[model samples]
Target: MFAVAADDCAPSDPTLTVQAYTVNPQTERVKMYWQKANGEAWGTLHALLADINSQGQVQMAMNGGIYDESYAPLGLYIENGQQKVALNLASGEGNFFIRPGGVFYVAGDKVGIVRLDAFKTSKEIQFAVQSGPLLMENGVINPRIHPNVASRKIRNGVGINKHDQRRCLLIHTGYDEERRVFAEPAGDKFL
Candidate 1:
């Protein structure tokens, strides 16, 4: 439950401090946390890819941001014996992976952790699991993708079922990396 909050635009504060913890080295996932100068409370802010050098130490950069977004990652700055961390997704830091059941706030253009396991399909709709069933950002839901299992097409001058058509496409596209997904029936492939 150790956490840290960070924002680049925040003014000087005497109380807040930034913290980081190792999550998974193989995945380069590191958890960042923040706390007050008076040691009252603390919480997690985000997880980022830890760039490590040959010495196996995190390459702490004064500049940080999301991988796909335009933003600057900020560290802790203490003030007024209280803590204030920026949660701006587009301007400060990168995307955050929130723990399931973890507390968070999502403003406009903000993305949060998504949990897919909680999704309940109605009337047996077909869908595929794209990612975690844990925490999700806003507008994210379960079954983001559908397992392409079959297709229909004319084969050998005979009309074939979707599944059969998929098999033919798979054979044709097996070696084609770019056309592999669309070349065959989508249902036949699974990630």
Candidate 2:
């Protein structure tokens, strides 16, 4: 489910450019290399996980990141054994439908999408463990975890339906209850 692909170039030289790709299956491990872009053969990049992914996501901070109540809009590049960077970012909310092959789409942010051909529409639904704050139930919106629906810090809210559908919704309001929507504008309207 996780992988990285980059141009064959010197790491110390930024000009040796590489736009990380996440679709390569061979880059799943901590260290790997490719004979060419889109090549069928891959060599080795390194021998240790610590040397490559020691700092976790390349663009992520060592102390604060997606975990432990920290988050950001920037896509975190988590590397495996090689310096292969994969986009590790959060997902958008609203009207999400996972296709039979695990293709997922949100209400917005369609310009760039990642597809995973693993989800089955016939897969059995199951309950999932939750963390952080609960947004609302019926009419009660709990703030103990998020404190306010308008908090820019909490971009999404977690919830569970009566039928047990674990959901995460985009918070349209700010911590002050003001109409402060996030996500990029799709065509003309902000999502």
Per-model C-alpha lDDT, please? 0.23, 0.23
RMSD, one per candidate, in order: 20.3, 15.9
TM-score of each: 0.18, 0.21
Instruction: Record all residue pairs in model 2 with backbone atoms less than 3 Å apart, i.e. clashing.
Output: 30-80, 30-81, 30-82, 31-81, 31-82, 150-174, 150-175, 151-174, 151-175
Task: For model 2, state the Cα shift of residue 163 in Å.
Answer: 12
Tens digits of per-residue lDDT for model 2, 1-191: 11122232112223422111122212222122222344322222232223444655332101111232222212222212222222322344321211111121121111111223322222121111112222332334323323233433323322222232222221222233321222221112211
Runs of candidate 2 with Cα error greater than 4 angstroms are 1-66, 69-129, 143-154, 158-191
Sliding window of 10 residues with minimal summed lDDT for model 2: 95-104
Range of the 10 consecutive residues with the lowest summed lDDT in candidate 1: 165-174
